[model samples]
Target: MTADDIARWFGEMDAELGGATLFLNETERQLVCSRKLFERRDVRYLDMRADFDQLSDRQVLDLTKPIPRVQSVPVMALMVAMYLGFKEIYLLGVDHDHFITGTYVYAFDLKAQRGKDDSVSSSGEILTSRHDDFQSLARLWRQYRVLREIAAANDVQILNATPGGVLDEFPRVDLDAALSGR
Candidate 1:
């Protein structure tokens, strides 16, 4: 649902699926091109990349331009929340500090996978990972700010409930406070 790469999973699982398919961008690209050639009338695709010139001045973020590259999936999730008419959005565990430690939470065998083509970094070094470097980290924050503007344009509020996260763009609230409707 987030990108074209995952669309094939829907087709592969469509045989046992019962829900509607919602893809981003072109529906045909997301479907009918995979190995199974899946197609359904219930499938719907939403294209949020309206031309920057056509959008009102209030909608400041030009997602179509692809500038200030987004480093996290939460950006897309936030946009989807806006489309779904969510007025209050709270985030948790959306940390971008994995680079600070030069390791991923899932990379349990960083030593064994060092220098592998698919591994996070070359030379088997874990401390020099640049994925979370200053520029990349800053981009994540800038993208979140853009999401904040977009949310405001749609009369929505985004709160960062991520405990101790480096992200300081949005107002941070306690997770319990958010969940208790306080």
Candidate 2:
């Protein structure tokens, strides 16, 4: 079934909160970027409110497989989003800043990144408003790079959503239509 089809099925489940758009990610960038891109009236969150995995696992046990050696918080969050039927899941502020200190960071691929932990990167969009955080831009950049590839094949649409970022690797998402609940 397609993402929309899954969404429709999930909607019928008793635990759903209407036809809501959920924000599943960490603080800093993903929160800011997802909010901007996945703009909708009932933008629910999965961070503290509800663990995406726990929210609906029976629906995704078949989809989310544990990445053996991969460990990025943004990527993990992305996995959770996918589990919850969020096909068009956007990694808003997921900039790959923390990976730069390591030389093998370049080994990160889209489907399965090679990082040791959740310290990926930031999107720098929301951080744009906070100048002091400028020093942390590199990590977030790398995150966008690897995440772009993983998201492509999964039927999930990952976009940068920054005002003017090129994202030579990822595609820009059209939020206008997706958020309309059409």
Candidate 3:
């Protein structure tokens, strides 16, 4: 999700979940802080860049292992889960292939509509864009390869349960089969 999506979701989530934890990278933190959303009492902000464990080449990512630098926030989140010692990590909605169409599968559509209504869309496509950079998406695929090796070394099973997703680094399991243990 984009920074705007994070901010908007943070507000909406606050109403339903009551002060949920929100993860932010530097750019996202800047955007949220500038809007004064960073000061909210119901929200706990995690600076992903600063908070994750840094691993060296000899280190592994596990409950006691440090996380190596990754290309995306979702990867960092996975690392955190690994640090928490989850035996199986099932990934859903990881539609990495949408970069081919220059769109995100989980786009901030309602937010986009509001922006269009308020003329925010007219400012520039780049400013309101939710698409990942083409090169960055390619890099993300490479990062997933490394993550797969790391997960295996730690005896953690990373299953790609996203049907039709382009991520083929991990074993693909049908969502129903994964949930039913079939």
Candidate 4:
């Protein structure tokens, strides 16, 4: 998620959401910490370091050490969940379809009104494009596979509750059933 998404969530649903823990990179944590809403709310920010190396081998993420950067925030979130001892992790809205659509649009910002077009990096750099040029979407899939292996080894269950799009690394579950503990 982008800074705008975080801001919007806190801005619009601050009361309903209660509290949130944001796992952000150093730069992102600094940026988010500067926000007024975050300062007043019960929000905990964790720092993660950038790791450009692809997940070439199966490994478990050690949270006590520096958390390695993944292809996206959702993947990073999965690592966080595992580290937090969540045995049954249910993923919601983890659609990895940017490669298919060739855009960086998110499910919440489908109209492209809040993200992609006006997204600014944590380093205060203006990003005009909707997609990243460096990494291929395939790398994301590979990272998910690595996460799946890690989850299996740790005896954790990861169920993807997303409606559609890519990301077939984990078993799919119905969102409603998962939410209701069915």
Best model number under TM-score: 4
Better of 2 and 3 by TM-score: 3
lDDT of 4 by residue, 31-140 (tens): 55677665655544445564535444445676656656677778888888888889888888787665555455444423313433444443334454535533446577
Clashing pairs in 3: 19-42
Give the winner by lDDT: 1 or 2: 1
Candidate 1 ranges beyond 4 A from true positions: 1-32, 37-56, 60-70, 106-132
Query: How accurate locally is residue 136 in candidate 4, as Cα lDDT from 0 to 100?
Result: 47
Worst 10 residues of 4 by lDDT: 107-116
Task: Name the lDDT value of residue 165 in candidate 4.
Answer: 67
Candidate 4 or 1, higher lDDT: 4
Over 1-182, each residue of candidate 3 has an lDDT whose tens digit, in order, gives: 66576677656645555555554444456666687774655333343332222333423454322234566666877766776678799988776664444434333435423443321333323332344355566677766776777788878899989878688888988999878989
Decoy 3 TM-score against native: 0.63
Decreasing lDDT order of the candidates? 4, 3, 1, 2
What TM-score, computed on C-alpha atoms, does each candidate reach?
A: 0.60, 0.31, 0.63, 0.66
**Per-residue lDDT of 1-182 in model 1, one digit per residue for the tens?**
33343554444446555664543445355354553444563544444444322434555343334323235667767766766677889988877666555554532333323344343555433454465366666666767877777777778888999987577778899999888988
- Candidate 4, pairs of clashing residues: none
Q: Candidate 1: minimum summed lDDT over ten consecutive residues — where?
A: 106-115
Off by over 4 Å in 2: 1-65, 97-150, 163-168, 173-182
Candidate 2, residues 48-123: lDDT per residue as tens digits?
3232223322233233332312234555565556666676765454434422323113322322222222333322
Pairs with backbone N, CA or C atoms under 3 Å apart (clashes), candidate 1 = none
